[model samples]
Target: MQKVDAVPKTNKSYTVLISLIVALGGFLLGFDSAVISGAVKGITVYFEMTDSMLGFAVGCVIFGAMAGNLLAGPLADLFGRKKILIIVAAFFTISATWSAMATGYTEFIIARIIGGIGIGGAILIAPIYIAEIAPPKLRGSLVSFNQLNIVIGISVAYFSNYFLVNLEGESWRWMLGVEAIPAAIYFLSLWVVPKSPRWLILKLNNVTSAQKTLSKIGGAEYAEVTISEIQRGIAKKEEKGKISDLFKNKYATIMIIALGIAFFQQITGINAIFYYAPTIFEQAGGSTDSSFLQAIVVGLTNLVFTLVAIWLIDKLGRKPLLLIGTSFMTIALLMAAMAFNNATYNFNDDTLNKISDTEIKIALADLNGSSFDSQAALFSEIEPKLNQEQFLDFKRNQITNFIQINATLVLMAILLYVASFAISLGPVMWALISEIFPSRIKGIAISVVGFFNSLVSFSVTQVFPWELSNLGPTMTFAIYALLSFCAILFVYKFVIETKGRTLEEVEELLTRK
Candidate 1:
């Protein structure tokens, strides 16, 4: 007879099989954020609306976010994580279906808010839940899956909007509604994924059920060790957090870091471009078709660069990536701001209506492989007319600007912003959220952090259109770029490295500090 080893199964396959459902929440979050880009155009047309209305319509999701995040922490802690997630899935399904069927702007806005709430929680919870459950060796990559799902969702939404926008009638509504499919999938996926053992033991005081779930994920031997670690955490946890507890200098710092990151992300003004890039391009000198095409490009670049961050986070480590990315993005934003500044003009009359002639010349140049020369010639000719003209033609410069710097360069800059975000703010902030909090109060802190993050999202999304309207693109972008630099500094000075550490170890380090 031979003794056999009883080490827990660490098969990538098993973990992945269970994780498939958990990641669905990420998918839903991404889909909901982007589906609005498509709806904004049709909704504006359908409702005979304008920029302010469209802006409100698009940003309304943050309202949902505010509510979702407010409730997500207490609910998760009170009922356990999986139960809250199941509730989130239901919200997604309902919101998506209703959004597609919305008759008026009010209906649509309400649905998006409802849907946004679900996404806000899922976005925050999915990664944390995944991180807490995975083996230490696989945590980063496994958690990165949450982000990967989000990108996929954004990508799909872009593609969906593209396909749906051309449909004969109310295509935008269809685009909004179609997301219900994934929402349903997410709800269904939750059926199989086990509850977080740590949540179960710590909050529910159910060590046995937690052990069984842990054993299923990691086998008996690993479950025993996992249970032991979770209990240690349970012992370390003080009275669950009070709002007053956050006032303590130590916890206050944690809350500030979280809120600071959230604020940094918003003030970067990425949402201005995201929610209104088409309009900005239109202002810059692009046609509806070109603007839509450019919007798709932005989404693709966002997805690809996010993938880049996911690949590199573990390899490059967090600090260097954040600092380097912030620098690159800031430069691009400045370049864009300058480009927009150069294109600024004050045409006074129906000149925009008359720019057909100029577009012809630009088109001829394009047809002849001399596009740049002709385009430059057109802009040089038009700039003075637009700058000087008062009432003869108010629109010529706007239309001409589209052909000049609108589509390509502006998109390049915005993509740079997204790239920076994907690498620095996008993934890293979430990583920090999962990392920096004390484990005892991690859920409450995370929820509060997410609440403030959503607040930032709400503020950015709500104010960007107004700011862009008043401040103009160049100034708006420059300001955002500057804010991003400040964010880079914030992290470099105050934040600590959490990569490659166990949750337990990270908590110990934080407390020791």
Candidate 2:
């Protein structure tokens, strides 16, 4: 029999250092997920493709992520977190190199999907890896380093995209190729980090090595009792349970909660803003040349606010941030509606077209009004209905204006959403996941959550563009904002707070009737 202590005595600084290596996976995840912004427009121009194809090219990574996240748990369970981190980092490095070299639309799409595998693996692994070693008091903050890295990665990608695209040649290729440096750094760090002790004891059945790793993760005084308690938890599970037990009522509630957390994170449509940011900015009445610059601003906002989230989560805890963030998001969504309404209604007026046709004419020279009138006459003479080209041009202008207003609104919403996510859906979800599972089922359950989360991410990423284009941006975002509202319902009624609770303490709470 082993005693389960209330907490582990780990040196916080050393433990966080190790977790940061795993968190590097997050940096790659953010970069790969977002770097598509720089390439979307240039890729379209280079390949001479359509919007639908462009969406597919960008969204295919989410599809690949579905499979990667599904595999993350089992692989991490079997191989240990350190080994898997190395593998994911390698996948990213290769994918980056290949993506940069891709010549055609199909090749680029394939490369993006491949990169998504790394993204999925990184997200699933980082939290699990960090949770395995983190002390309860520090766990939330430490795991959140993953989100912090994610924002940094997004900002870096944005900056890199801007700088690289300035080169005289194909700038998108350079935008993608830079990810390899970070991936390589992540891989090198894993060599020195110790494997998760809990993983060794429970999954590998190696007590001595587990104790050795635990002694370093926590101090020796801490590791002795902590390691004993961890094994006891595993032993208790071995005596009384099976994987199917997770489907029963006690565990089922937690599973539903975990799934909801995953779904709402994506349903907020944050990724949509990230994915189509430049395009959204372009629609907002900006030139193609300026869209990337706006994207950089969005990325910077994401980074700055993410740090705000990291600082706030441990202090204020998770739920409050979520409440504040979602409320902000809802208001932002309404404002977006207002912006799009302006764009949708203001399309194709003859007055606007007359203003654009004066190429070299003086600003004070109002004589060119007749030139648009003549062109309008010729267009009407040919078809008699509203001229298709002029109507499309008008719609484009309106869309640009609409996009501009909505995008500005979206940026504010995204900032709030990012802050909220950094605290709640971002870090707390993973903490709760680790907390809910009994030690015996931790590996499998983490994998299951990872699978479902990744799959939801894939579905949301793929469906949002079509929904936005067909249903209109206002409707699409409104639907996502609505989902966030529904998520509030789920959390209020069912969620259990896990902050500052020990592994045993959290598990016992789950068992309560």
Choose the strongest candidate by lDDT. Answer: 1
Clashes of each: 12, 4
Instruction: Give the runs in model 1 whose Cα sits over 4 Å from its true position.
Output: 1-10, 344-351, 354-403
Give the CA lDDT, 0 to 100, for residue 445 in model 1.
Answer: 77
**Candidate 2 RMSD to the correct structure:** 5.3
Ten contiguous residues minimizing lDDT sum, candidate 2: 370-379
Q: After best superposition, candidate 1 residue 205: deviation in angstroms? A: 2.8
How does each model score on TM-score?
0.86, 0.86
Candidate 1: 10-residue stretch with minimal lDDT: 388-397
- How high is the CA lDDT of each candidate model? 0.72, 0.70
What's the C-alpha lDDT at position 448 in model 1?
79
lDDT of each residue in 34-65, candidate 2, tens digit only: 89888876787688655567667888888778
Clashing pairs for model 2 are 283-400, 284-403, 284-404, 285-400
